[model samples]
Target: TNNLAKTACINIVTLNSVAFYIFIMSASLPSSMRKLVVKTLTSNFRKAVEIQTVPLPNPASGHVLVKNHFVGINASDVNFSAGKYDPSKQPPFDAGFEAIGEVVAVGDGVSQSFIGKSVAHLSNGAFSEFQAVAGKSILEIPSMQPQYIPCLVSGMTAKLALQESGNLKPNEKVLVTAASGGTGQFAVQLAKLAGCHVIGTCSSDKKVNFLKSIGCDHAINISTENLGQVLKEHYPHGVDVVYESVGGETYETCVNRLAVKGRLIVIGYISGYQQPMGVATTTSARGAAALPVKMLMKSSSVTGFFLFHYANQWKSAFQELSDLYVAGKLTCMVDDGSSERKGGFRGIDDVTDAVDYLYSRKSVGKIVVNLASSGSKL
Candidate 1:
């Protein structure tokens, strides 16, 4: 009888404690600082992107606070959400890298000029409505348009991969896999600008048309046409430069199709991003072989590219791309499905759908998500 009475008292005390904690938490959250927080990590990326209200953080010394206007959806974002990109990033880790916004506040040791300036940056925690970023990394932009967000990563990557790493020569036969993708589209245009004969591969006729419109000399629909056959017949002499992102069969074919002294740039392998990490398996279809023998026999080279590794080149590269844009030589193709809706995929609610569209292999260009409802037109 005494033990039963003690148990009842303990249960009541526990319930009171829980209620008090909930009340305290509720009272602490300010209405203005609401943000999303990833509550859990799941195999389904959409389910993994959970929405929670978090307190907006203030910038620290050497950092600026940004009110996010737009954010970009890269293939890596999906992989990050799925826990396949970085093992250290377990549940509750914030995802997203590229974003455009206006500086609302500056921290100690930061210049006051940063306030009220429009900027773009590549950083973690971009999935939220507000972020504190190192002021030195911010790039001043003309507006909050999502179009400029790609220039933060994708454009710079494409330029450096071809002009610096690949060393593409005029009239060189260049092939780009996933040509209609965010980074791939930039590669197609940049290769053409370098006077290289650019060929791009996609899965749909819609993307094929988009590629051609962007100066691609040839577009191969991998879904309807055989990538190997097309390369064998048209590029019998082998390709001089290959900007490969899609892995698996596409990667194997690119290795086999390299010309003597050819250069193949490895940007990513989106085809395997959703599969098991760092393990050889069936569903992944991530395979390639004869690399050492093939490279030695042909004097060809393969270079792996990670954009952040070339941080020093960002300023100059952005200047060059911006100049091209002003001169009408560079184009920024952002897919937000705005045509289907008045301002499609605006707000955090549509991020899941935006990511789904990217992996669907249907989008022909960069997939951008607008955080500000008013900035959703692009």
Candidate 2:
């Protein structure tokens, strides 16, 4: 009888302690938070979106509340705002995509221990001070550093697209368009790591140098040298794999240069993102109809890769990328935004400028906006 009473007392004490912890965590968070919302669907992000203060989101069952520290800016932000990604969805919706932060609170069915853990997530409405996300959806990263932000989207895209879509093989010739850009850099490094001779395309000598430093065997400054001429003269046999992101002319160039049975993975078409939504599609469709003949001649094929479609592979891809990064075998290059704008991109207010910077074609690597003033140690 005495033991049973003592046990009941201990359980009551534990329950009270957990309740106190939950109350404290909830109380510490502000009643209101600022977030960017898309009021209109337009290519002009700054004009379409507005910052608004709203009540802090409570973590729903099986969810966790996170305080975002950094958010990654992608070239596709314009497409998102323009409603290219999803035409069916109507606005006044949340803005932004991927963010890294620390979990501050957990809801029912979530362990209290998860609170204060560093996590990263790829979801809508990431351009906010705080977000409530599903516990399972959040990936616990090594730290909240901006470098890891690229790995969540760009790195995974490169790694998975190459392995699954490109069918990359060892000792093969690989070409990566926009090699100095976010996903392009990873494609270059991953191709090199897979024992392929990597050829990267850039717009300037600076980008060429950056590509070379990241193990690109050949960095072609397309602004100066003709991409087709250089590939034809040096790599007459053609490349076995092409990670073609830049569309239009670059896409045509890649199709013409594919080796026998080669694969070209089309992850994006940034060249056309600035154009009217359907304008690029019309041009691409016309060109694509003729690609069958070119591909048939070389016995090659073209495949489209969208990251969200391969959700099951994300965790494994991110884990491998994180391991490589920790081992110093991978470099997560993040553009500081100083080259384009003074003082660089910092805080939520600078997210729109960061998006513009990405479109300017001046950024060398991943563009990330710093959200937190200080970071928690790994």
Candidate 3:
């Protein structure tokens, strides 16, 4: 606990120990002051949020203030919001990752070029009105930027995943699982731009057409048709690169389909973060494919990617992608959501509705949220 909070808690316990002392303390405060003190005390997060003032935070050098315009609600935000992840950090920390904001207040020892330009970064806690982040963490938005914010996130992430893991070459077949999801949709489009024959896997026939519209040369409905058999029909020889986004039984199958000397990029494992069904299960499909022993013999590579780590470490590479986005060689998808609800809807609220749309496996684009902006429609 914070020292101030600990001291306040201790004061409460001590106040109760002496009933007579409470009366003495009550005498010390005027009636107006007592009321003011009582009013400042909060009962919940909503109460704590009821405010107008932004505290004057003392930022060290290399930090700049960003007046934010957009923030993206990631699946990781959902996991963090639902309290499903381990070590459960206390509530009241801001939740969000990718946001587009303009530089406003810069701390000492930084460049003047930073002010007035828009930027995107990897750190969470972005679901707020303003932020102060390290200079290196923020990247200036490209020339051909979209009017909306989430596109910056999708474009950056898609380029990063493909370049880092697969190093995809022209016309090499790439298999993207969870092909219609927020991130997977980007993978499909980028793989095609790189001159790869992209095959995407979705949950239904409805999304299959959607995937094909976005540069997927072939699509698979994993719920009905078998992924292994479908790949056998399309590539025949074997898949050149496997972009493993959905993990579980699907992970096993993706690993199995890798061609000899093919690469498997372990991009994401959404299955690992999901709530359990009260039982354990197993799968065996993927038979004798992409074995660890065989991978070593063939000199094949398997790389694990986490965007949070890479954006901080590889700043130059991230900038190159920003340039690609402006070149129009890359395309991204967006689902702005329906306006059926209240005053500007966003975040986990939209996700709860979008999850059903996603579970139905019909959504064919990157999921986005438009946070409350009065007078604007969702």
Ranking by lDDT: 2, 1, 3
lDDT measured at residue 56 in model 3 versus the true structure, 0 to 100: 38
Best by TM-score: 2
Q: What are the per-residue Cα lDDT tens digits for candidate 3 across 1-378? A: 699999999888865655445344334422210000011222221232222224534336988766555565455544454444423455445555666677665678877556667787656656555667888788777531333344445555666778877889998989988887777877888888788999998887878878977778989888899888887777777788888877767777666667877888876666654443232222443434436775776566677876655654445655665555567654555654553445333532343344344443445565555433423333
Q: Is candidate 2 or candidate 3 better by TM-score?
A: 2
> How close is every model to the real structure, measured as TM-score?
0.85, 0.91, 0.70
lDDT of 1 by residue, 5-33 (tens): 99999989977876675455435434454
Per-candidate alpha-carbon RMSD to the true structure: 14.5, 3.9, 14.6
Q: Which has the greatest lDDT?
A: 2
Candidate 1 Cα misplacement greater than 4 A, ranges:
1-43, 83-85, 279-289, 339-342, 374-378
TM-score preference between candidates 1 and 2, better one: 2
Worst 10 residues of 3 by lDDT: 32-41
Candidate 2 lDDT, 1-378, residue by residue in tens = 999999999999988987787788778889998888999988888887998999999899999999999899988888888898899988999999899999999899999988878998988999999999989899998776888998988999999999888777789999999999999999999999988899999999889999989999999999999999999999999999999888888889888898999999999998888776677533467677888898889899899999999999888899899899999999999996866556567777888878888888889999988887522221
Candidate 2 TM-score to native: 0.91
Worst 10 residues of 2 by lDDT: 369-378
